[model samples]
Target: MITLSESGVIEKIEQCSNLDSIASLEFYSGILAPAMVNAHAHLELSHLGGVVPPQCGFSKFAQCISKSRNLFSEDECHNAMDFYDSKMWDDGICAVGDISNGSGSFETKRASKINYHTFLELFGLKSCDKTRLNKLSVVASELGLSNSLTAHSTYSLNCKDFDDIVQSNVEGILSIHFMESEGERVLYDGFGELHSWYVECGMHIDFDKYDSPVDRVISTIPSSRRVLLIHNTVLLESEINSLKGHFGDNLTFVLCPRSNLNITGEKPNFRLFSESGCRIALGTDSMASNSSLSLIEEMKEIEGVPLATQLKWATECGAEALGVGDQYGRIEIGRRCGLVLLESVDLIEMKLTSLTSCRRII
Candidate 1:
């Protein structure tokens, strides 16, 4: 059992019967582990929940979001943000690597108990004022939170915008939507639904200047640093090899399996990533594309993988990625890692069943 001071700071951890507590507590029969971390999320887009349909592909999903994103009032967005933030906390998530296009989440994060590292997102596909990034960066710094200026995705950033964001990403943590779709790379080759979608949307690009989407992005950023590559629904073995050559211990592939399924009806070739010995992590992209923001729901969508490995990805790897490695991710004493119960997960199959649910015990 864990002993928490009235102030919520961790006091001590000891065996249940041996521990003495002046306060009352609840107990349950389940496996206890460190609280989970969501490595990639979009709190700014929470207002767009269920505004887009599943299996429609990222291109169409982007189009629909573009059309309806601004329709919601600030109050509506704030409401969704509050609800989702509370939902993740109740689901045993202790930290999050959340993407924010504006300061919409700044106020909410200021009042939140969960550890948050806001990745101020810069998108070039449409347009973004590069100057605003420093302002947000300063604000995040003043608030005593970890923050990084990051890109929206491989496809959305043009050469100028990508370069600018890379220069500003000094904090070592770079979270990006890497190769979430083939269109990102295929648009360079001149034939794909994504290319067509881009043309129709008037976001045409000159792909002839670069080798491929992934290569172009890799070339622009730092070679040795923690780069949290998100989605990667179509990342290739060749690309993984290239990444390994440049980023040794600095690469982390943040998998959003359920969100990938919801948007594009596919998952990354996770076998290739695992076989390559790539550091893996888990995320709930957003409620905009996914039905649930539960990390357990994301794990349930993944099959043929060891549960322990994914659990490490969801907890340890995620904590490291968000710059909170010392504070959370393990059950060790003095870590302040909140305890959580994994209910009904089958150790034999290493698969999460419907009965499996995460309960916060601390």
Candidate 2:
């Protein structure tokens, strides 16, 4: 049996041999686990939940988000973020690495029960507003939230903007959308639908003499700080090797399979990631590309990974990547990491079935 203090910190853990005389002992039917950490999310876009169509491909999906994001009022967007913040709490997410383009979701996150590390994401084909990004980071800090100025994607940011973000990110985790679509590859090679779309929109992106996306990342981004590479949906074996060789254990590959499926009708090679000996974590990208911000639902999409390994990915790896391991990933003593009881699990096969659901227990 596990015991907790009134403030929710774990106190003691022991096997229950005889519990007839125990005082106020609570028994749960299903497996007990630590609350999960969402290593990547865009809480600022929660208002666009069902507005964007599913399986629309990355280029179309990007266009849809750009077009539909401003359709809602400020109040609607904040309310949606508030509602989803509570939903994620109810779904047993203890910590999150949330992305923000502005201060729209800041107040909600300031009042949230979940631990949030805000990533102020910047992106532009010509130049990005680093001053504005810094101002938002200051806003988050003033509200008593941890934050970092991050890049949106390898393909979105111009050379100067990308280099500025990397150089300015001295502390906290640096998150980037890495190789999530084929369009990203084509863009790097200076041709494809994404490239043509940029031209049609009256913009031409330059890769700044880089050989490949991975080369730009390796040559520019320093290995001194922690980095999270989100959405490796199109990562290749050679790219993985190069990244691991350069960043070593300081890099984490955060997978958002459900969101990938929703947008591109495809997913990363789970077996390849699992066998690559690289650090792996899990995330729910956003409601725009997913049905809900539920890690359980995300876990259901991981087909061949063992439930134990998936749990590690959802909890420990995520917490480590987000630098919140001391408080939110494990059930050890002294940690205030909340407990979650996963119900309807297929214990025999060590798998999470479609019926598996989770609730916060402590």
Candidate 3:
């Protein structure tokens, strides 16, 4: 039984088979778990929903986003953000680790009932935005949200890009989109379509500048700090082994299966990551690249993993990634964690069937 105070903070927890002894308590037969967490999301991009084409390769998709991001008016984007926030809440997402290229989602986040950790995502094609992070941090702080200055991806961030970002978020949760597509292999030998596009756009870079894009990113961030590596679609097994040995305590992997399939028609090598026994989480990248910001679709699409493990990835691991484990991951005393009920799934067998759906309770 969960005892929630009037203000929604959990006061006590009783581990029992039933709460039948409690006075006038109505109970149902369902499996209770912590509310899900969309560990990596771009709520500000909600306005771009249904605009970008599906199954477009990463390079072309990036171009489409850049060209169409400013098509909507400011008011329209704000409305879309609010609507998307409600959709996540309706789907029982208690917390979100959302990425923000700018401070556009600040007001909606401030008014949201769900918990949010804002990531000020920085990017530069050939240079770094070394000076604008402090101002962005102030905006997040004023809105009363946990914020971090994070890198967008391994390809875009350069040596000069993270001077301010690394210092400001030295000890916070740092997230990066790492090797999300096969095209990212160009950084090593300049062979992929992404490299060809770079040359076409006149964005030249020395492929020999670093051993790998992952190495270049890891060197800039402190090893002691927690780093969430999002999108491991193209990372090699050898690279995973090396990083696991070096950054075990501070590394976590995040998968957005639906987004990956929607863009590249393939998902990450889940078996590879699962065998490593690394901490994992789930997310919906953005509406621009996905059908909707629902974590359920991601959970359903992710196969080869056990249902219990997938649920843990969607909830507890996500909470841990967002730095809210003690308060939001599990159903425990004094946690104040939101709760949801899993319906239609086989509780006895602990399996997720096609009929499975979630119902939010608290």
Candidate 4:
């Protein structure tokens, strides 16, 4: 028998002489473990499932999503959010760093039994200036969400817009979609498939506008704030090494293997990040890009790694990434009782069954 304190700490582990001897004692079966921390997710995009691609490149897939966004109804969006939230609970997720485009899902998130902190995403080629920032601040204040800020990825926002967003210095967490696809890399480097796609889409192409996308954005952003970089499917070892000097303890990388595979059919260099001492976390993304909101499933899709390492990504690493490592990641005393219980299975079987209905005790 194990006793986990309310603060999520493991107080005691009692071993009975035998199962029959412990019959009089109240005990829960299965594996008692720490609650999960989902480091990145777009809950508002859950409604566009099959409408997106099952096996399309990132650029085409993104185009499909843009085209389908207006087709969804308000009630459908609410139902999709509810379904995704329920799925997270079943997988033992206690906290989530969810991203919202606006104030649409604030009521749904507040009514749910999960701990949610939203980052209002802001991105535009020409409109994410002071005017947009002020508007976002007013909306965020009205919703009463504690933390809100302007968000941008390496390939999305221009230099001035990125600077303005960072300059606002909003509280809570700052998240951005990093190198998730080849298109992003191309767009940043000014010489890839996505650059041409951008030009073809009628978006302005200003090659001399700024230096490399990563360098400019990193230079302007405050490194003290906790930053979660999602996907990073195309981030090279050298790039990770360069950030080592700049990122201190406030930067983390979030791996969304299922979403990566669904979009670009590739995975990031996990071995490199693990060896370089980079902080790492796991995210299920959303139902639009992924099948379900199951961190265990994300852990399972990670190939060529040990189970212990993968488990760390889903638990401790994610908590650390979200700046709540001390409170929710592990089964330690004084931490909240956010825990999971997995069914007994061999290592191989455990990995395979992690995605479905493996036992969960939160």
Candidate 5:
């Protein structure tokens, strides 16, 4: 039995054979594990649940999101954020990399029980402007959120916008959607089925106007800054190798398995990442594209791998990617005691059911 104080410190941990050994327990469950860290999620778009439009390609999905943005009301947005925050807490998410499109969810984050670093997302396809950048900085500072510039995706941003985001010089954590689908890779390489779709949508993208988006982004962004590259389903061997060489300990790949399957019907090459010495993490993404914000579900979807490795992706790797490793990832002395208790069982069953709701005692 272990007790976590109100300040998130571990007060006591006593080994026991039965439930009666612990005194005055408020919550009881099976096995106790360290609290989870969700590496990537867009909380601002929580209001658009169940609104994912059927799209054949990544470009079509982008267009659907663009069109659906206007349909949400301010109150609905607030309610959705609140609902999602509560859900995360109930599911034992101790820390999160929450992407905020605006300042509306600031209060919700401040009041939530979890430790959160909100990334203020910014994107402009054609050109960059200092005025807008300054305004975003001020808003970020006023809200007391971590200021991060995130490019929407490789295929979505122009070079000028990408450069402006990189030059913000407000460095802590950098995030970007990388190769999520084969179509995205093809579009960036200037030979995809979406070429006509881009034209039909009135987006005049001259593939010759810029270099490869992945290469260009990696070169422009500082290698020293800790990066969380999300949705790397189509990332090549060469790109992973380059990242390993340049950003030694500062790079992490965040896999959104549910979202990847939903959009592209494929999963990332976990074997390649495992063998390449690249750290990996997991995320639930936005409810708009995913069915829920449950890391347990994400874990189940990617089961059959070693249990220890999967747990590391959900806990330590996520903390490292979000720049909170020293404080929140592990269950060692001097670290915060953000923990989850699971239903007690034999070691084999415990490993298999640790992430399920039936096993959780947050």
Candidate 6:
């Protein structure tokens, strides 16, 4: 049996015995675990949920977002954020590592019940103004929001701006979009669809000084800071070894399989990550690239991973990656880590089936 205070703080946990049966005790059918965490998301893009089609490939999807992101008015965007924020809460997500390009999601987050760690993402083919990032950080801070300045991706920023962000963010956790698409993998070789697209847009990418994207990342980002690498859809085993060897326990690989499968028609090799024993976490990228922001739904796409390991990815690992472990990852005494009851689980096989669904219990 488990008990909690009025405010939801756990008080005691004891295995129920036949003599302890009490009329007031409640029982629930299905698996009970801590509330899940969404390690990476774009709440600001909730307004473009169905606007971008699925399986369009990364390059075309980027173009679609560039065109459709501003189609809705400010009020409409805010409404979408509010709606999705509630959806995530109802879906039993207790914490999130959200990406924000502007201060658009700040007000919604300030009023949200969910814990949010906003990543102010910076990206540009040319040198980005460092002051702009600081200004955004100031905005987030003024709103009393937890935030950190982060680079958008390895291929999105020029070498100077990317290096500056990496070197200057001496505190707080950092997240980056790593090797998500085939184009990005080949862009380091100076020949890919992404390279051609950059040329077509008349933007210059100064990345030739580095040997490869992995080399640039290793050389630029300090090993001291906690970093979350999002979307290893195209990451190689050797690259994983290099990263694991360098960052050790300070690094986390966050997977958004559903979003990746929707956009690029490919997902990460869960088996490889499992075999490597890396600290893995889960994410639902954005409604713009996914059908829903539900972590349970994201969990359904993960294959070749045991159910227990998957739960850890959805809960404990994600909470640690977002730096909110003390309050929301486990169901220990003194923790009000919201309880989630997962229904329709295959108890016989110890797996989550297609019909599995979750609801908040505490």
RMSD, every candidate, angstroms:
2.6, 1.3, 2.0, 2.9, 2.9, 1.4
lDDT of predicted model 6: 0.90
Tens-digit lDDT track of model 1 for 1-362: 56676655467777666334645755565567789999998877888877898789878888888789889889999999898888888899999999887788888887887899988888866677878987988888888867888877767778888877776556547888888877777788887888897777788665347888767766787775668889888888888888878887788889998888888888988677777787888999988898878998888877666788778888998998787889899876567778788988776765678889997877
Q: What is the TM-score of each predicted model, taking all chains together?
A: 0.92, 0.97, 0.93, 0.89, 0.88, 0.97
Candidate 5 vs candidate 6: which has greater TM-score? 6
lDDT accuracy of residue 98 in candidate 5? 85
Task: Report the lDDT of model 2 for residue 346.
Answer: 87
Report the C-alpha lDDT of model 4 over 207-256, residue by residue, as the tens digit: 33555556755677776667888888988887887666677677888999
| lDDT of each residue in 67-157, candidate 2, tens digit only | 9999999899988999999999999999999999999888999999999999999998866889998888888999999999888888898
Which runs of model 6 end up more than 4 angstroms from their true locations?
A: 18-20, 24-26
Cand. 2 TM to true fold: 0.97
lDDT of 5 at 257: 86
The 0-to-1 C-alpha lDDT of every candidate, in the order given, reads 0.82, 0.90, 0.83, 0.74, 0.74, 0.90
**For model 5, how does the per-residue alpha-carbon lDDT over 1-362 read when each residue is reduced to its tens digit?**
56667776776767767876657857554556788888888888888777875334566666677789668889998899999988887887888898876677788887788788877666545544546645765776776665666666666666667666666564757788878877766676666756667666677554335456566666777787777889888888888998778878888999998887776677887777777788899999888788888787787677456767877888888988888889776777667837775443346644655435622343
Rate residue 262 of model 5 by lDDT.
Answer: 72
Q: Candidate 4: lDDT of 106?
A: 77
For TM-score, candidate 1 versus 2, the one ahead is: 2
> CA shift at 300, candidate 6, in angstroms?
0.7
**Clashing residue pairs in candidate 3, if any?**
none
Candidate 3 has its poorest 10 consecutive residues by lDDT at: 158-167
